[model samples]
Target: MGKPTGFLEYKREAPQKKDPFERTKNWQEFQLFMPEDKLRQQGARCMDCAIPFCQAGTTMAGSGEIGCPVYNLIPEWNDLVYRGKWREALDRLHKTNNFPEFTGRVCPAPCEGSCTVALNGDPVTIKSIEYHIVERGFQEGWIQPEPPKTRTGKHVAVVGSGPAGLAAAAQLNKAGHTVTVFERDDRIGGLLTYGIPDVKLANEVVERRVQLLEAEGITFKTEVEIGVDITAEELETSFDAVILATGATKPREVQAPGKELNGIHYAMDFLTANTKSLLNSQLADGEFISAKGKHVIVIGGGDTGADCITTSIRHGAASVIQFDINKQKGAMRSGDNVWPLYPIIHTVEDAHKEAMAVYGKDPRSYMLQTKAFFGNQDGQVTGLQTVEVTTELKNGQKIRTEIPGTERTWKADLILLAIGFTGPEQELLQQLGIETTSRTTVKAPYGKYTTSKPGIFAAGDNRRGQSLVVWAIHEGREAARECDRYLMGSTRLP
Candidate 1:
């Protein structure tokens, strides 16, 4: 420990964010970097807990609450960074996580919540320090492709190039296996390049990582649909093992009166199209989904919804209204969600802050229910008919009841549906004859990713449904280990 008592001496310092008014004008990340010395001081705040729960990654007994799923060695890395050992810190981070940049930028940082320091004052700025370590690694040319010394005869095929798919391919390639990642999109990285907004994660970060993976001898095939272009049985015979990291791509739909309006779009479609159009000139032409000078109504108050709000504000939207069906959460942790659990608190992310700057108040409206979508002459969505609703549990079922005399209408030219996804797309999964569970996720046992058929494995969102990028990376690594063991009767991978 560089400074054993540094936690007492220094106050918690996070990355400074740009002013809301100034930041909303441009589509870029708002979090300004902290000085190196200040970051080191923040790193020094990691107390020497007897049992570090930050890295435990275990679900609490009877509660089902878990720590970091990738099992990050939090304290070790924090101490390394605190001691000014940047190279060593990067090495330690890469031990468990293949992509810290991705997680550091967007991860909710449950590790901080479970930290011992969080019980009293502020927790260690673990995520910021992590971001610095990885970013410096690239700047210092420490991050390089590590081609396997010896080539194993085994060949493996990884479907999807998101976090999970990339992790699996990286590990498998490192283990001397010829790895090929198949992506349906034009770009190699799946959601990383499309679903997430560039303001959150710039496209260059994803491209750089993909380039490293390519340098490491992993072949990537973009714009190729697996089931439609390539058959499952063909993959079975072609590659010794096939790893299905095809994420949950199907968007959940909202049933309303005028659901078939022209202006209504799924969040993924909106976000993906925007990023795609920005990247390629071909797609940028013709009526791009612009929110400029228009009132935008975003449904579903999740991360994707926040992203939509932020993106719309960046597009010079006149106003934005974010709606959530659930009640507003408390400022502090609730009774049901105690210590060490990822607390469900009222969080105003960067998007909400931007919206507040543009509009008078925060754009979030809780307990708001959409009664119907009103369309114009050409079947284009013009407004949303909504009502205030109360939730109740009756006869072992939960329901939402509309409040009397509370019907209202909000003008909206663009309506983005940011409600969560509903498992993986069925056409490809069904065509491959893979069985899905009741929740529609691929039927695969936890920890062991083997499907009903031998030599077929599934992981990530396809297996666990829509989840965090960290969980997807964890699942990918686990599935890779299982697939390796299944193929060669043993594996050295963790």
Candidate 2:
């Protein structure tokens, strides 16, 4: 709140992005940094509302009424940034979020959705300001490793190096406990390193944070899986506390005719392979599922679906199309979509924009459901059959009905499933002897994060199903606080 009238005077100015066609030429990040003067102006647009629902971080109305799950000190940081207190702004940012850079880049920013200013006009540039604060902190050398002065002599084992596991390890180490993170992959940063493409989140950004965690005394052991490389019994005996953040790697699939076609693959498998290959040899290793010169059909219309389209276009796919089971949303919010809730409106994503620039049209087809797949004698997928459907929102539930005589075949050589995930894989959970919910997530209550087995805790997608990265960070921090109390009969973490 630098100036009381700043919200009205200074209109929202988003950071410039590289041309879609130009950015697709390579895998480099497309977003360019905003000027410092403009960032300060954007921060001043924060209206000092009495009750900032921006940080409510709760669900309401069985609706999408959610906000910043990490509950960052939004107003404080906004004010600090407006007043040019760059270092102080970074401090307020880190007070709530362990990894602002990741959230700043990838988070949907429910904080903006729930901002009071959005009731009339645009919300403050909360996400951009947060991103710049941490980036500036690193550039100005304000961020550095500060190892705990004393050791508690307790050991913690975190299985997974994703956002949640890393957050838990960071907090546990801050409390003077020895923390060791185990990842099945050769490199650390589970989903961050592989699930997400480097175009959206560069590899170096993750590596920078990992290096800092190492300097702060947290240990990361890659290529060592708990259920395979190391026994769960060994983990139980070796550490005072154990955290399961392996995430929901189980990909949701469609059970249609000819589903076993060779070209059909899970979105994560495609993204992971592409990222790994890119890092290893800029995709020269031919280790990834290439969309080059092939017709790609992606199912599911969520963030992952968007990513699949973007990645395919970057790979020089001949034709790319996305199928969405739900009907297309409107540009404006519906009557049911009230304030403080995430506005249910349609907006073109960067991925769609890129697709349009390359394909000369948006690649998304709405209200379409898969029926079956068609494959050649060689077992390679050739196309898919789908039926047009109508959707209705009855009593806040989506009811989809397939229309008769609307089934049609669409040609495709490659299909990527981006629907979502069922829950965490059961192998590690079973080996650890921990109880899971009916949905397959570990049976850890929200806020309490306690599993069936004593001394065992779970968080992130493993505990909450597939969700935003910010929520994973929130649960990880809270779990660490609870784990610390369990280890020492009391806790100093916040």
Candidate 3:
């Protein structure tokens, strides 16, 4: 270890965030980078635990406990950072994570939750250290495209340009296979480029990596739909193997009245158009669903809901409110959810903080479920009715029931449903004759990633259902190895 007893000497320090009031005025990222010395101190907080649970990547049965899904080499990189060997840290980071920058920015950091230090003290700022390491690598010219020395002369078509697709493309290209990525959208990055707001992850960051992938001989074909523009048969015929990294984009619909109203929309649709408009003309084009001067109501209190609330605030929304059916989590973890597991505790995110600063109150409400949307004569949403609900255990199953006489109505000119995605769209999977699980995810063995049909495989959100970007990257890397082995009878890719 670079500093023995460093954990005792230093307290955990995170990057400073720009003031919510000021940062909400624009779409730029608000997180300010910590100084090099402070970052090193943060790295020093990593204890030399005999069993480092931070990198274990374990999923305990029925506990909702998880470690890093990508199995990041946390201790190695933390030591490198503590020693001020950032270039070496970046190399170690890239060994497991193809896109550390993406994960560093958007991932919820389950690694920190499972940190050994987090049992009694604050966890080391692993995510911030990771972000700095990769960003420093790019700035110092330590990161560059490593094109394969010799071509395998085998072509692989990767459908979808999300994290999974990009990771698969990168790994397969490294193995000397000619890889081409197909994206239905005009941009190369699927979720990172569109679904996420610029305030959280800037488009330029995504562009930077896409450019590097291009430099490394990975071809990105944007605006090319697999089932629509090019038939599934064509892809199978043109490539040696096809990997389906298309994300789980089929949004879980809110089965409430007046869902077809004009002002109601899916969360992704609203977010996607906002980002596109922002990038295209700085919102001058007015091509997106504007929340300006509108009373916005977001249903579902996950990351997507948080994004919606923040975006609406940036658009100068009259008011914003987020509703969740689940009971609010406690301020601290319960006894059952002790150390080394992700704590089921309530915490304010950046969006919630900004909303508090702007609206003078937290915008999230628990145990409230939308009953119906009320609309005007023009069919635009005017308001929504919700009822307070309570949960009770019946036969070991938790069930929600509406509370009588607690129905309330609130004005809401705009409604964004952020309830989360159900699974991948069925068109492409059906066209390719690929089997699916009972949950509607593309059927593939746990590690093999092979579909029912030969020469076709699945990975990422499409295979695992909606999950974190880190999990997508993990799936992509693993699936690429499986595909490579299937095609060449052996694969050296890690």
Candidate topping lDDT: 3
* Candidate 1 colliding pairs: none
Residues forming the 10-long window of minimal summed lDDT in candidate 2: 58-67
Candidate 1 has a TM-score of: 0.96
Candidate closer to the true structure by lDDT (higher is better), 1 or 3: 3
Residue pairs with clashing backbones, model 3: none
> How many clashes show up in model 2?
0
Per-candidate alpha-carbon RMSD to the true structure: 1.8, 1.1, 1.2
TM-score of 3: 0.98
lDDT of 2 at 310: 82
In model 2, residue pairs whose N, Cα or C atoms come closer than 3 Å (at least 3 residues apart or on different chains), thus clashing, are: none
Error of 3 at 447 (Å): 0.9
Candidate 3: stretches off by over 4 Å: 392-398
Please give, for residues 338-443, the per-residue lDDT of candidate 2 as tens digits: 8888888888998999999999999999989999999999999999999999998898778989999999999999999999999999988888889988888899
In angstroms, how far off is 243's CA in candidate 3?
0.5
Clashes of each: 0, 0, 0
Q: How should the candidates be ordered by lDDT, best one leading? A: 3, 2, 1
Can you write out model 3's per-residue Cα lDDT over 359-417, one digit (the tens) per residue?
Answer: 99999999998898889999989999999999886876879899999999999999999
Write down the TM-score of every candidate.
Answer: 0.96, 0.98, 0.98
In Å, residue 4's CA in model 1 sits off its true spot by 2.8
